[model samples]
Target: MKKIAITIIKFIGFFLGWAILSSILPLSSSENQAIWRLWAEIMPLLAIIAFTFIFWLIEKKNIKLHLFDNPVKGIALGAITGIVWLAFPVLIMYIAKIIDFDGTNSIDLFPVWVLAAFLNVIMQELLVRGYLYQMLKQKHNIVVAAAVTTALFTALHGGAFEAGVIPVLNVLTMSLLMTVVLEYSGSIIAPVIMHFLWNGIGALVLDGVSLADDYPNMLIATFTGNEILSGGICKMEGSMIVLFINVILTALFMFLKNKQGTK
Candidate 1:
């Protein structure tokens, strides 16, 4: 109980710091490409730098840390986790009649897909899944650790941007999935990559036009149809497609975990 309390308090503090910084810090306007180049472009890098020590400190350990027994195997496992995390959600959104098309777009300034892929798969993975997740898991039960960490993850998005129960359900489910990824691999690294890729695709590549866009049948966001879907509950719920995707990928993750456990 005491350990859990400490973990919860520290978890809240870390995110409070991050959220305050992110919200108060001057950021380039999302609309301004030049501003994005100047500000948004480097924020992820800054976050990575900040998190390195912050996460290290959270674990109360030296800089060198290794959750996985094998380095090469960990990397491979992490990559596979990333692939599943990214692939399934998109597939579910598509199959459930949530998003109509592939929803890929071209931006003149950068190779949006490449950048998005890198940012989503690497940057976020490093911070949330790699650092924070590991730190929390050591102190709390897996479910608690995952939930707290993921809540921070979702909250960092400046509160539940999507409205309705669907969006909340989606985040909760994804959080558990991510937690499983981290637990199964015995490393936060794999799940972190998965997280980064998933969001990068959702924010940059898709351009806020997804299955939820057409079906607003059960979504709640103040800014629904905009290029960036903000401030409402997401539409991961009420869509059988996304649920199906989650079920399959979750099973796969578990299967791998069980295999490794028996070994």
Candidate 2:
């Protein structure tokens, strides 16, 4: 209980610090539309560095920098999981006629967009899966740790609430999936790769114009959007079908992991 409280406090401090730092950064129109644009681009990297340093200080030698014992296998499984996660939702939406590809748009600053996405996922997976979940697991069982981490993960996304109940629930389900990935893989690498792919592909499929409004991508596909099925503010990922698919996939992954362990 004390550890949980400390973790929560640390998270709150981290978020508050990030918000403050982002707010104070100066904007340059030559670079982007607004200060927030630059903030959105760079904040994840800063957060990653900050959190890593803090964790190193707190955990000392116990902090494991290596995300997995088997880097190759972990990375491969993560890639496969990411691809399946993205592909399944798109397939379901296409078949259901919830979305239609209108056309493609040009990507702007492709390299930077990819870097930002990578950093964002690395920071999230490290903090949530590598740090918080691991810390909780020290005192509590895996179920408790995963649940706490998932709840915190869901809460971190401010848009989840505005997107509606389904979106929030979808986020929770995805968080659980990520937790399972981390648990079974015994590494943060799998979840990191999976998360990056999820966000990168999602950005491409949903908005179709850019990785983000601020950062445009060379390859984009415009789609007919339905608020209910397409996720009005939440985008394609917030859809019910996508959530259902994620639940099934997560369960399958867990079952396979358990079977492998027994064998």
Candidate 3:
């Protein structure tokens, strides 16, 4: 429990620092966005380095030292995890009628937007699941550890929102899926890459919006056809189809895990 407490403290501290820095930085504008984005990329890496070293120093395990044991497996895992994890947000936006996706015609920013989203995912996964998740898992079972880390993950993103409850809840759900992937894949790289792809393709390309928005969504720039499924967040997240797919995928993962455990 003491280790868990310390891990939580470190996670909280890192988040607080990141929030403070993000507030002071100019990431919103087109001119200085690159610089701030670089900072976003660097800050988390530094945090992971420092935090992992600290955990190693105290735990004597140096679990992080083995983070790169299987590079190929990690990448593959990340792709699978990303596909499964993105199922929920895709669901809520499409099936629940949670928010309206007004089109904004942001085709121009596609390239840079994709880059930024991927970088965001790589750094975030490294920090939350790669570094923090390992530290916490050392002190608890998989389920408990994943739960705590997922909560922290959600808090880090949703902390910036006004409708705090929903965003946090959404993030937590996403984190749960991420945790499962990380565990099943046995590495963080897979999830990190997948994180990049999902945000890049799902949130930015298809959705054509920023995840930071209070329900930041794809602006329905123009509707071509299939009004029920064409424009808006549906294109980005894929309507009710996303939710059903996730439910099925998550169940499949659970079944696989159980079967593997028995073996």
lDDT of 2 by residue, 1-263 (tens): 78768767865675566556656655445544334444465765566567666765777747454466678878998999899888887777778776666666765555556676677677677667765677667655778778887887888775678869888888899899988877678787888888888877667434521235565443333335566676654656567777787799899889988987999
TM-scores for all candidates: the values are 0.66, 0.81, 0.67
Task: Give lDDT: candidate 3, residue 24.
Answer: 57
Off by over 4 Å in 1: 1-5, 23-38, 51-55, 58-99, 102-106, 112-117, 120-123, 157-162, 201-203, 206-238
Order by TM-score, highest first: 2, 3, 1
Q: Candidate 2 — which residues are off by over 4 angstroms?
A: 1-40, 63-66, 205-213, 217-228
lDDT of 3 by residue, 118-162 (tens): 666766776677656776676556666687777667667744244
> Distance (Å) between predicted and true CA of 153, model 2?
0.9
Each prediction's whole-model lDDT (CA):
0.54, 0.70, 0.57
Tens digit of per-residue lDDT, candidate 1, span 15-86? 556555555556666774533543543565466657566867756764343444455656777667656655
lDDT value, candidate 1, whole model? 0.54
Model 3 steric clash pairs: 78-190, 78-191, 102-219, 102-220, 103-219, 103-220, 103-221, 104-219
Compare candidates 2 and 3 on TM-score and give the better one.
2
